[model samples]
Target: MPSLVAPLMSAGCLAGAPQPSLPVEGGLLLRPWRLADAAAVVRVFQDPDIQRWHLKRADTEAEAREWITRWQQGWQDEVAAHWTVVDADSDAVLGRVSLQSIILMGGQAEISYWTAPWARGAGVCSRAVTAVAGWALSEAGFHRLELGHSVVNPASCRVAVKAGFTQEGIRHNALLHTDGWHDMHLHACVR
Candidate 1:
């Protein structure tokens, strides 16, 4: 064997390196965002519900391509790690989960998640959150995970609670939602 290292690297696998895929239950996998996912990404942003909560405007086709490009740049910048929640059986995109504002000095990370409107109530966000939190705590070496949601959004608060986060406190006008600035409930989990 003339050192298969080069071939392995080119193929995107190597011993002692991080595995690319994150396996979840029910045949779903959370993985890196792909440029080819622009269509689905646009669909997500086009959703009025997602737009309301995420505080984003509907994206045009050109803007959707730019969105995917930004996603790639985000990973490249170490500013955030974003994942696409995919169905294990059909490989359909179920949602998104991410760790943003990763702070090594404070050993903390901010967690965010969203599921397709159709995937609501199926525990998809919860599962995806658990996986991401585990990765941040263990693999990413984060000691604390923080989550925040507008107090008006009880569904999101419930998701955070279900993911083992402790309700910290309300931050007045913490978030500027589509409606306006709103009180946000902060949650944190220490590993």
Candidate 2:
């Protein structure tokens, strides 16, 4: 039953490496989420666009802290890796980027992201995604990275393209949002 190639990436590849702070364009940095950012997280989840796409909301700072806690623990579990994108000078929260559905066995993971209202139109999401994907593919030893967004979200498609991911195809009814199911455009980059 075990007829297959060896793991494309070693087990514990992520757990063995500490999460790192990454730099992005426009003086932004991607760092591990902290509990102190609970308030900002709540603020972002309030945005209707985010709620629609991300399909979740943080109505309270306590809930936001729990989310942050999960992101922290995910590093050890090697299931997900989330980062808060912030301004390098003032450390203002600008957005988020994450590697989800991590499969060390395949040396691959999916990328996710969002931009704060204030940071929209400033390319924060694209830049952060690029930085994170670059690190995941090169330093983190992942062979491939994927980015998927609702086909309805053209802006997200733009972010993926700008981040150097190529559009591979679309999946019908692949994403479940709060409203209903949505088709998703799939994008990918290989190291």
Candidate 3:
């Protein structure tokens, strides 16, 4: 029998990816999460609106620290990437974005993001999404990037569209939020 592992290992996939800070338009940058960001992470996850959609809450600084550590682990494992959206000039934490469930062999990944409550309605998430997705496609060599949100989340749908993802369809009862099972609107962008 042939060695299946050989082919996969030789694919030059994201086996040991490096996390790099990427600059975006409008004086914003996407950088790796830091331990010092625990306070902001806790604050963002504490918001009822964010918790409602995310279905998880980081109530304490310890929990927030764990969240950042998990992203660091993801980078070490080369399975995902997480970035903290910050103002380039002021260095203020504006939001968070991630390319999760990454499968480098398949050249695919899922994108997710949440904007700080104070940053919402200012197009921060949309701009961050565009920058991250473009980087994942062009720089990272991902062939397809996908994102989905509860169908009730028109704001997220708008952000996905604005970031160049095309709506594929709705998946029934695809995600369970705090409210209950939600139908998710799937969107994707292909390179």
Candidate 4:
């Protein structure tokens, strides 16, 4: 397999660490999701909230491995970047974030994030979101970042705002929710 560390730093997502991890506040660290994290990542998907807002089905260990493999490929292609949030003190997987669909015309990309059930409401997602967004703007050369949340997911909307994303507007039937198609609240942050 290709070295994941080199591509992440080359993508402008890290600096000077000679490693994949990005240190954040409150004893937390963010690094690229690896195949080894498949099982834990699948566990995060088991959270109903994660499935609901993320609009994805549950993942088996095999599927998680494949997913991480694809994430690595995306980094190689310069198409997207992914990170696994972990506790710096314990190295426990807490969640994930990806800066995807980067567009230079708009100089923007979409941010997707989720927290393990156990980590909710403790400011983990907020800090990770802010850290990644800051890196994207300051180092990754992105001019704006966007996020969309199902109208019913107030928690995600809260995270977006807490991370400095401004509520832009709502899109009718912008996303398919667990129940059915639903409107999405659009948010954006610009440099």
Report each candidate's C-alpha RMSD, comma-separated, in the order given.
7.9, 1.2, 2.2, 6.2
| Residue-wise C-alpha lDDT for candidate 2, range 73-112, written one tens digit per residue | 9888999999999999999998999998999888889999
lDDT of 1 by residue, 3-81 (tens): 5333211221112343256887767899887777777877777777788898665467677668667765655665566
Among the numbered candidates, top TM-score falls to 2
Candidate models: Cα lDDT each: 0.77, 0.92, 0.88, 0.81
From the highest lDDT down, the ranking of the candidates is: 2, 3, 4, 1
Which model, 1 or 3, shows the larger lDDT?
3
Off by over 4 Å in 3: 1-17
| lDDT comparison, 3 vs 4, better candidate | 3
Residues 9-72 of candidate 3 have per-residue lDDT tens digits of 2233554446889998888999999999999988888788898898678999999899899998
Residue 69 lDDT in candidate 1:
74
Model 1: which residue pairs collide?
Answer: 27-88
Candidate 1 steric clashes: 1
Candidate 1 has an lDDT of: 0.77
Better of 1 and 4 by TM-score: 4
Q: What residue pairs are clashing in model 2?
A: none
lDDT of 4 at 126: 88
